[model samples]
Target: MNPTTLKLCLMAVLSLVGIGLYGLMICRNLIKMVIVLQILVKAAALGLILAGQMSSQINLGQSLGITVIVADTIVAVVGMALAVQVQRRLGTLDVDALSSLRG
Candidate 1:
């Protein structure tokens, strides 16, 4: 990749991280938090890919990206399922409300 392209990728990764953190801090809804978490995970994968590209280890980067995606998908799915149960049982998805759970 050209220097310009590398710079662009770095900027994108940084922006994604910043946006995800901001969302996580400001959002109270469980679903929104999950979405923000996905953004952070994607940013991490992107950073790994960029590192691989810069290091000329394309295969390693691809494999790592794939693994990250798989793991992130599993986590997101489980989180969503739990969020659904929380909404059903507690009648709310707000973090503040869910914090009231004793167990």
Candidate 2:
């Protein structure tokens, strides 16, 4: 695409990843952590889309993006499952509370 558009796209990806990282480092809620992880995944997908637009191998980039999306979905499902279990066992969804979880 246009050079300006490409720069904007890259900026958007950077901002998205930055937000996710900030959330991950600062948030105490397990659910919020999961949501931030998804945000990072979305940023990755956006980067892949931009890569496809910039390079000659459009199909390759698209396939990689799709793969990332599928992997993210699987991870989200598993993460949510574990979060649910944690909530049930600990009666709280806070990251600080997870420290008390023991086998």
Candidate 3:
């Protein structure tokens, strides 16, 4: 692909990353924030993969992406479980509303 096209794609990825981060920061709901955070993480992984591949380091890029994907899956599953438990116990998933910790 041409450098111009690559630059455009990078810009688009960066824009998505920015929007995801902004949503994560501004969202009051736990689920929305978590989803946005995941998006941000994925965008970062994409950026890393793109950079690595552009450098002719395909193996390195694949390895890095696999690691990130694995970590992301684990984190997302655990976080979702925790969020569900919290919502059930607290009756809401709002961050500010959560204060009492169940022993």
> Which candidate order results from sorting by lDDT in descending order?
1, 2, 3
Estimate the TM-score of every prediction. Answer: 0.92, 0.92, 0.86
Model 2, span 10-101: residue lDDT tens: 99999999999999999998888998999999999999988988996788889999999999999998999999998998899988777765
TM-score for model 1? 0.92
Off by over 4 Å in 3: 99-103
Query: Lowest summed lDDT over 10 consecutive residues: which window, candidate 2?
Result: 94-103
Top model number, lDDT: 1
- Higher-scoring candidate on lDDT, 2 or 3: 2
Clashes of 1: 0
Q: Which ten-residue region of model 3 has the weakest summed lDDT? A: 94-103
Tell me the TM-score of model 2: 0.92
lDDT (Cα) of model 2: 0.92
Q: What tens digits encode model 3's per-residue C-alpha lDDT throughout 26-56?
A: 8988887878878988887888788887898
